[model samples]
Target: MLAGAARPRMPASAARSRLVEPLSGETRLMLRAAQLYYRLNLTQDQVGERLGVSRFKVGRLLDRALRESAVRIEIVHPAARLVELEDELTDRFGLGGAVVVDVASTGSEQDDELLARERVAGAAAVHLASLQPTGAIGVSWGRTMLEVAAHLRPGWTAATEIVQLNGATSQSARPTRAHEIVERFGATSGAAIRLMAAPAIVGTPGLRDALEQDPSVGETLAAARAAQTAVFSMGVLGPESVHVASGYLGATDLAALGEAGAVGDILGRFVTRAGGIALPSLDRRTIGLPLEELRAKTLTVGVVAGAGRGPIALAALRVGCVRVLVTDEATASWVLDHA
Candidate 1:
C-alpha cells in the first residue's frame, strides 16, 4: 500500500513487550532473542551464530525488541544526588541556578569543615571558569570570594574586564591581600582589572559622597553598574569575620548592629532580620555598589559555605541578594532545613 497523509496511530500494545513476551505463537520467534543479545552483551554476529541465523536477522530482532520495550535502561551519575537540592533551591528561592558540591565527611569534624570549604571554593572556581565571560564581571572582596579567586585556573574567561564592585583600597587592621584576589580573577579570566581606589568605609557620609564623585571612583562605579555578572559573598557578624578582623567595624559597633536586629553583612552593609539594611547611618559611610544596584544585576552569584553562614545566606536569598549560589552539601542542606 502506498503511504497516505493520514495514517492510523499505532496501538499501544504494538510497542509494548509483545515482541519479546509474545501474546500469540506467531510472534514468539524472538522470545529469547533480546535476552541472549542484550542481557549477555553478545555481538550481533555471535547472537546470529548461536541462533543459526544471519547477522541481519539478529539486528532486526534487536530493533523489534526495542520497539516492544523489552529492555529498559537507566543511567546513574555521581552527581545525581545534587539535583534534588538544586531543584529545591530553584523552586523555593526563584534562583537562576544552584551548584552544590558533595564532599565526603572526614574523621575530624573541624578538618572536615575546612576541607568542605576548600572543595566548595574549587567548585566555584570551576563554575566561574565555565562561564567564558566576555564582558565586565563585578567582583567584591571577601574571605570566600578570595578563596574562589585563588582556586580559579587561568583562561577560564577571555577578552573580559574585571571590575571592583566596592571600594577596597583602604588599610585593614590586619594584613589582607584583598587586591590580590581581584588580580587573580583577572589573570585567570584574561580580563583587565579596574581597581576602585577609595576607602571601603570612610569616616563620614559626607566624605564618602564626596569621594564617589572623584573621577577614578566614578569610573569604577560606572564599570560596576554596567557589569553583566557580579560575584560576591555575605559576611557573618562576628569578631572574627573579615569585616571585624579587618577593622571595618569594632566589637562595640557589632554589638550595636546586633541590638538593632542586624543578622549579617553583605557588601559591607549590615542586613536586618527583615531583609533590609540594618542601619542607614552605617550604609551612608560604606563605599560600594548600592544594595539595590547589586541586587538588580542579572547574574549575582553568592559563593559561601559552612554551617555558621546558613542564617545569613538564607537572609540574603530571601531578600533577592543573589540569583545563583555555589556551596557545599552541608551548607545547602542547612539553608534548606533552616530557611
Candidate 2:
C-alpha cells in the first residue's frame, strides 16, 4: 500500500442486487434485522443486537438496501377522460351541465369507500351553486336526491323558488317526503319551497280527485309544471331499493308494479325497459307534473348510478326524459355496451 493512501471500507458480504439472490448468513440476518427494525417499528440497536450485528453496521446495510430497492411511487390525477365524458354526454343529450365520476372497480375496500365518497350530492351542490338564476327549479325526491339537498350550498338566491315534482307520502312512517327535501333545498338556495302535501298513493281514485282539488296542492302542481329545469333519479325495483327503503313502496306495491311490467320508475310513474311510461295508476293519484310536462322542461337532469340502474337510465335517455345525465364511468360504459 502507498504511504498516506486511504483504504475504502468494503461490506463484509457482497451486496445482492435482487432480493432472490443467495445471501450469506450474516447478510440474510442483516436483512431480517432491517425488516424488523423498519417494518416492525423497532430501533436500530434493538434490531442489530437481535440479529448479532453492530448497530452501526445494521444502520448502514438498512440504508444501502433501501436505496438499491428503489420503490417507485406515483400519484395519478383524475383523467381528462372524465371531462371528455362530461362533454360527450352534454352534446349528445343537450344538457346544461354534466358531472361524471370515476368509480372504476379496483377490487378493494378502499376503492369502494372512495366510490361512496363520490356522491351525486356534492356534484349537484356544485352545479346549483353555479346556476344562472332564471326560472323555478323543480326537484324530485329519493335517497340520492336527499343527499344532494343536504350538500346544497346555502344563501343562493331568495327569488329562486323550489317546487316539488311529486306528492310526499308512503305506507311506512318516512315516505318520500317532498316537504323535507324541498325545505332542505330552500335552506341551501334561500328560496321559497313549495310542497305538495298529499299521499304518494291514495286509497282510491275518488280520494285522489278530491285531494287534487285542494287549492294549495293545485297551486304547487302548477308551479312544478311550469318549472324550466327538473332534477330526478331513476328508481330501480326490488325490496331493498331506494323507493322501498324510503317507504314509498311496500311489498304489495312492488308486486303490483312488477305485474304492470315495470322495469323501473320515474317520479312514481312505472316505465318499461324501453322507457315507455306505463301504469295508469300513477296518472290517477300522483299530484305533480305529468310526463309531458317534465319532458317540456328546458333541462331535465337525471342523476343515477350502479350497474343495475344502467338499463333504466338508458331507457330514460331513449325516451328523452333526461336531457342531462350525471353518473359514474361503470354505468356509462355499461349503457354504451348495452346500447
Question: Clash pairs of candidate 1?
Answer: none
RMSD of each: 10.7, 12.4
Most accurate candidate by lDDT = 1
Scored by CA lDDT, what does every candidate get?
Answer: 0.81, 0.72
Clashing pairs in 2: none
Model 1 shows how many backbone clashes?
0
The local lDDT score (0 to 100) that residue 279 gets in candidate 2 is 67
Error of 2 at 43 (Å): 56
Model 2 / residue 259 / CA error / Å = 4.2
Error of 2 at 73 (Å): 24
Off by over 4 Å in 1: 1-78
Tens digits of lDDT, candidate 1, 153-211:
87888747998888777466574456888899988777899888886778799999988
Q: What is the clash count for each candidate, in the order shown?
A: 0, 0
